[model samples]
Target: MDCKSESGLEMQNVCIVEDDDAVRDALAELVESDGYRVLSYASAEEFVAGADATQVDVLIVDFRLPGMSGGELLKRLNERGMRLPVILMTGHADCDEVGLGLDVQDVSFLTKPCDPRRLLGLIGAAVDGKG
Candidate 1:
């Protein structure tokens, strides 16, 4: 995508780091429909390598992946000083276990098959600095 708003201005960037192809694609569609520029990756490692972590306005990531978990990615980003709004999701029952001791601000959690309205609301809040 061109990452531009309808008014010919630059739009906010939202990144999704998910290993599941279907989940990632669906999330990208949802986020894009909300008018944010969406950048997606299949793994935390791919996201770390392919995109600048500091530039994205918000990050929506899966808590569990084949390689590095979402919590680890958040920790690594924190260590690198890239604090931003994050929405972490997972199908596992141990949702509370994610992002326990991370210094990143504006963090929210969502279970798998999350409500689109709630997700969009969180994204809006994050973008508006209310998260």
Candidate 2:
């Protein structure tokens, strides 16, 4: 799970935006274990304020956040010309509900309680530009 390049620098960055502390921590741990650098935030606003979208390889976000829904965040990113691979995870909503205002490419949806292996696979595929 060493995702560093030949020079020993991390090659992939994964950002997780989830409002729940437990979920965010668990996701960060999972993604980090797979060798990707993980930066997590409790909400989309926090992510927007702290993260540099250009450095992100993949974004895993919750559909409903405390401030600025995941779909709106993606829209803003898209408007800024930052089209990164995104995985939208939700516990109560489906794609139709979450994608209402979303307009971006290289995006996928995963329901809550998503299989860890599937998430890892999606992250790998996203980093490889095949997801």
Report the lDDT of model 1 for residue 89.
92
lDDT of 2 by residue, 1-131 (tens): 34467878767989999999999999999998998888889999999999888778899999888779888888888888888899999866456677665755678889989999999999999988833
Candidate 2 worst ten-residue window by lDDT: 92-101
Candidate 2 TM-score over all chains jointly = 0.88
TM-score for each prediction?
Answer: 0.89, 0.88
Q: Which stretches of candidate 2 lie over 4 Å from their true place?
A: 1-7
How well does candidate 1 match the true structure in TM-score terms? 0.89
